[model samples]
Target: MSEAFGSVLWLIVAIGILVTFHEFGHFWVARRCGVKVLRFSVGFGKPLWSRKDRHGTEFAIAAIPLGGYVKMLDEAEYEVPAAQLGQAFNRKPIWQRIAIVAAGPIANLILCVALLWVMFLIGKPDYSATLGPTQGLAAQAGLRDGDRLERIDGRSTETAMDALQVLMLAAIDHRDVAIQASDANGHEVQRKLALSRLPADFDQQNLEKAIGLVWHFQVAPATVGTVTPDSASAGLLQSGDQITAIDGQAVRYWNDIAPLVKQWGERGGEAMVEVDRQGERLALLMQPRQQLNPDTKQQAWVLGITPAPRKAPEHDALRRYGPLEAIPAAFRQTGRMASDSLAMMRRMLTGEASAKSISGAITIAQVANATAQQGPATFIFFLALLSLSLAILNLLPIPVLDGGHLLYYLIELVKGSPLSERSMVAGQYIGLALLAGLMGLAFYNDILRLVT
Candidate 1:
């Protein structure tokens, strides 16, 4: 399938699962509380498909397929018969009302944990968090070459992604943190990362650039591992030869070789290639064969030599556990993610982090497609993360959300009565405005990311 189609398809599936579970929580709890539920709908607007259960509760799959809701029999929304007044949602005890309202987010949290368990049972592949070349704050804090990252602020980081995530948050909050790593000799070293020095305009999206932490593989040596037969370098440049310079220009890394060779081929002349063959320096003059590059669809130079592959670093980890062990692991993982997410929210509120950090449906769909392509484990992790985020957002004390209702109920409990209709309506409008602003910001960030 095309990328756009794949993204849309996955987005629909993900929302379907999360929304269904959330609605189910409310449906199940309301029934248990002896309150009558009118409809259970996944998505909104016109119903595409619907079925009525024995209790006359209409369950529906609607046209929109974005969100779902459970409609409870409430005296506030509709008139109730005298005989069925006990079944009205508003007539229920304050605690039962609170339980029913709180169930949706709780269900999402449960789903998040369950997804994480499945993800852990199937390991995710990721690059090791090996510390590469360091500059600025990283170098000043004593981070050195060939060091494999072990932990940040006592939180263990097993992948490059893990280390980068912790560093990004720390940089956002300008929190100086202690880190642990193993040197090239397999000896442990600890240092304080001076993230407090990060400039106010630091970009969370490009933390590596601001922090000066690069992967070792990104700076591979310019050593030739293979030379194609009858190619320009076939007879002259043997395997294991390090291309130090080309046409009197320095070839600092493997990436430098290609462009330099292209320049010489375009100039249509023999170029002097310097090599360090097992530490013995030698120079050879050879002309590059010019050919149309199929991938780029342009005429380009060809030396027909591939760079030597770099070995995997020491801290490589597979995030898998046995089925029995995965239970606790899943809970631990969820707690860590939730903590990190809340910290990010706090920083954003305090203006320590940019609001552009938020993402809307567009970004979610794109990321969903990418993670699905990566593998099942990664996709599962993404789903769990999305579910947890949804749960937390719904719990916020704003009107027109699960959290907002809970807040109103709490006030009702304290005052021994519901708020005035005028006050409740006013709260709803305020809640809607806040939600609109947040969604606008999220969409703006997603579009900005697409444009730039």
Candidate 2:
């Protein structure tokens, strides 16, 4: 299937599953509380398909699949029969009402753990937490080649991803952190990473570059994959050509090309570009093409050649757990993700983190498609993250959300009554306005990412 179609389809499937679990939480709880559910729907708006359950609740699939709700019998919303007065939600005790409203987010949180458990049951392959020769911040921090990272800020880092994640988060917050590593002699070493030394204009797209940490096995050979049509290297460079030098500068790895390209592209001169093509060395003098770089949005010179796709090397790390062991692992993983997510949100509110991190449907769809393509384990991990996000977002103290309703109930419990209709209505408008602004910002960030 086309990528776009696949993205949209997977997004729908994911949202459907998450929403069903959320709404079912309320449905199950409400039923157990003896409250009559008028309808249980997995989506909003007009019902596409529906059936009446034995308990008289109409279960439905709606046309708009973005959100769903459980309609409970309430005296405030509809006239109730005298015989069914006890079944009206408004007549229930304040504690039961609170439980009913809180159930959705709680359900999402539970789903996150369950999904993570399944993911752990299926192993995840990862790169070793080994680095090449360090430079800049890393070198200054006393890290070096052959050192394997063991922990960052006391959290174990078994894979490259684990180390990168911790480092990136610390970099973004401009926080110095302690790292523990093992040297070639198997001796433990401790170092403090001065992330504060990071340049204000560092490459945001490549957080690792600013930290000067390179994966040991990720350095690909300088083999040409494809040359962009009509560019400087179009006719001169061929596939499988190994670039040996650019403008008389030695090029040993794919990562070595960009700096040289920029250096020559800025000097405004035709330079000798040497390549080994089928064991014959060929040299071509060509002026590096100059154009605006989309990512950095600055004028940059380029050869317009892409590196060949590398084959998957042997995995140096794996995260797998037995069925029983996965339970606690899932819980721990979920807690960490939840904590990090909350911390990031807090930082964003205080302007300590970039608001550019916000993303919309486009980003979500793309990520869903990518993870699904990778494998079931990765897809399950994505779902767990997404599910946790759903839970936390719903728990926000905004009117019309689960947390907002819980807040109202709590207030009622304290004041011995519900708020006035006018107050509740105003709160809803304010909540909608806040949610709308966040959505707009997320969309803007997503579009910005696509273009740049």
Provide backbone clash counts, one per model: 0, 0
**Tens digit of lDDT per residue, candidate 2, span 1-452?**
99999999899989999999999999999998999999999888999999997889999999998879899999889799999999999999999999998999999999999999999899876678988767888999999877999999999888887787787778877789999999878899999999988876566558778888887777787899999999998889999999999988888778889989999877887899999999999998887888888999988888889999987667777789999999999999998889888988897898766788888999999999998987898899889999999999999999989999998998898999999999999999999999999999999999999998
- Candidate 1, residue 127: Cα displacement in angstroms equals 2.1
lDDT by residue for model 1 over 363-419, one digit each (tens)? 999999998987899899999999999999999999999999999999998999999
Per-candidate TM-scores read: 0.84, 0.82
Deviation in angstroms for 189 in model 1? 1.6
Q: lDDT scores for all predictions?
A: 0.90, 0.89
Q: Runs in model 2 with CA error above 4 Å? A: 183-187, 199-206, 216-218, 224-252, 256-315
